[model samples]
Target: MQLDATDLKILQQLQADGRISNQELADKVFLSPSSCLRRVRMLEEAGIIHHYCAVIDAAAVGLEVDAFVQVTMRRDVEQWHENFSQALQQWPEVIGSYIITGDANYLLRVRARNLKHYSTFVLERLYKTTGVLDIRSNIVLQTLKDTQQIATSLLVAE
Candidate 1:
């Protein structure tokens, strides 16, 4: 779908506040309520606006340890990759997982209560997963920036 400047503005407003009322959103984007609603519905139908969710704080919820784990696989097989992907979905500690072009096959963002809990997950669960050859982890000491918002202004430029 071809998104215009108005669509970009609407997206930016939504990204800032997903729960903003249709009337408020329409005012912000300088459109009628019905038009704004129609545009938003179109964006949703196009899968541009995937889903609305509340962002939670990990530390406030007793999750103190955040680690970036690099996993190397024993075999470069499609089935092994599929199995590993399925296994990740079952592990709640893993918040994010990605297949990247690097020494590791997968990179996982894990959240735990503490270092001990993180270690336990790595030792018991991650290591035991089939085709897992090696694992490296870097625990985050401080989080400088973390956000789900995408730059809609860039979309306008495109």
Candidate 2:
């Protein structure tokens, strides 16, 4: 899946504004509308463009409390890791989770209406999860930045 300068420019523009029209995109990338559409389709077929989504404000939706929970496991085993990941994906409140190179086995992002709601989640579910040796939660004071974008500037260098 090698991308030319035009492809890179198209991707960069789309990443900046996904809603940009095909005509606008083609003009920006210096391609015909049909050619641009074909390239976009090719990117999708190559799995380079995974998915499109709208970013929503958690606070605006009434889930005001943003939290990070660090869980230390009894041990890291393939079976335990697989089971944990499977169980994790089923829990909707567990917005995002990561396996990190740190003391904690996994870091989790959780959203709730408030501290009381978060506490209930911690006690009932997070505490009850199997193979969890310890847990520490940090409530967010404020969010400075959060984005799913990757830098497109590296494409040319690569």
- In terms of lDDT, the best-performing candidate is 1
Q: Tell me model 2's lDDT, rounded to 2 decimals.
A: 0.87
Model 2 misplaced stretches (Cα beyond 4 Å): 76-78
lDDT string for model 1 (13-123, tens) is 999999999999999999999999999999999999999999889999999999999999988666899899999999999999999888998999999999899989999
| Worst 10-residue lDDT window, candidate 2 | 75-84
Q: TM-score of the candidate numbered 1?
A: 0.96
Candidate 2 per-residue lDDT, tens place, 1-158, comes to 98888888888988888889999999999999999999999998999899887888899999989999998887755577777788788777899999998899999999999889998888888778777789999999989989888777777764
What global local distance difference test value does model 1 have? 0.94
Give the whole-model CA lDDT for all candidates, comma-separated: 0.94, 0.87
How much RMSD separates candidate 2 from the native structure? 1.8
